[model samples]
Target: MRIPANRMPTAAAYRPDSRDAGIRRYFGLVQFALIVGVPASRLCSWRHGTHIWVPSPDIQVGDHPGWSMACIDAWVPGGDPFLRPPVVQFADTAAIRARYHGMPASTLWACIGDGTIPRPVVWVDNRPGWLL
Candidate 1:
């Protein structure tokens, strides 16, 4: 029997599709940095997650009321997939910029502009579905 190329295959098609078995595609590594900070005027409360970006070693944005912003930076891994994978961690703005080395100004900002991408299930350690 001849199969038409335009039609989508059902899961049962995989039973005889040996050509599809050998090739696997890797999406590559993704990293996210969760930043939390507090303003100098407000007492740091562990219950309320808040943080301000520190622009410099001496200048903490937390003190400036006009400058309250909390954010996360995600990094996409580049280079050999087998080697250097994407590195993700919870860190301050400065540390993230340092570790990824200008990734914020480059790839990171572009991604943020693209809009919210869904968080992967592996990252949702405390999500409601898992708690049950």
Candidate 2:
């Protein structure tokens, strides 16, 4: 049975051990991609392989299906995905510069390159923003 994407649950609503836990508590492909920082198309292109871990949906939701947070968390390299908090807050270079007035951009870059500053959680567009 096809389920509408809108009717699918969000990641925040998922509870791993709840009685209502099932496909209904999972995230659809689009939502999963957003949470995992991968493109939806890349997720779609995955094929079952011995080395690759692919999450199976407990139930179908319309044309899209969902994967449990537990399953996705397991596939992630780190420890308990939900239990971990972001190590730092992210800010753009300009913000960093403003925070450290009088510091040269070159020095800032050098510090970042030499580990004086923490690296970014991820790059948005072409800008590198650090995680606090």
Clashes of each: 3, 5
Can you give the TM-score per candidate against the true fold? 0.18, 0.35
Specify the highest-TM-score model's number: 2
Distance from true position, residue 49, model 1, in Å? 23
Runs of candidate 2 with Cα error greater than 4 angstroms are: 1-24, 47-52, 77-132
lDDT of 2 at 68: 49
Model 1: ten consecutive residues of lowest lDDT = 123-132
Summing lDDT over every window of 10 consecutive residues in candidate 2, give the lowest-scoring window: 77-86
Q: Evaluate model 2: give its TM-score.
A: 0.35
Q: Report how far residue 2 has shifted in candidate 1, in Å.
A: 79
Point out where model 1 deviates above 4 Å.
1-89, 104-106, 112-132
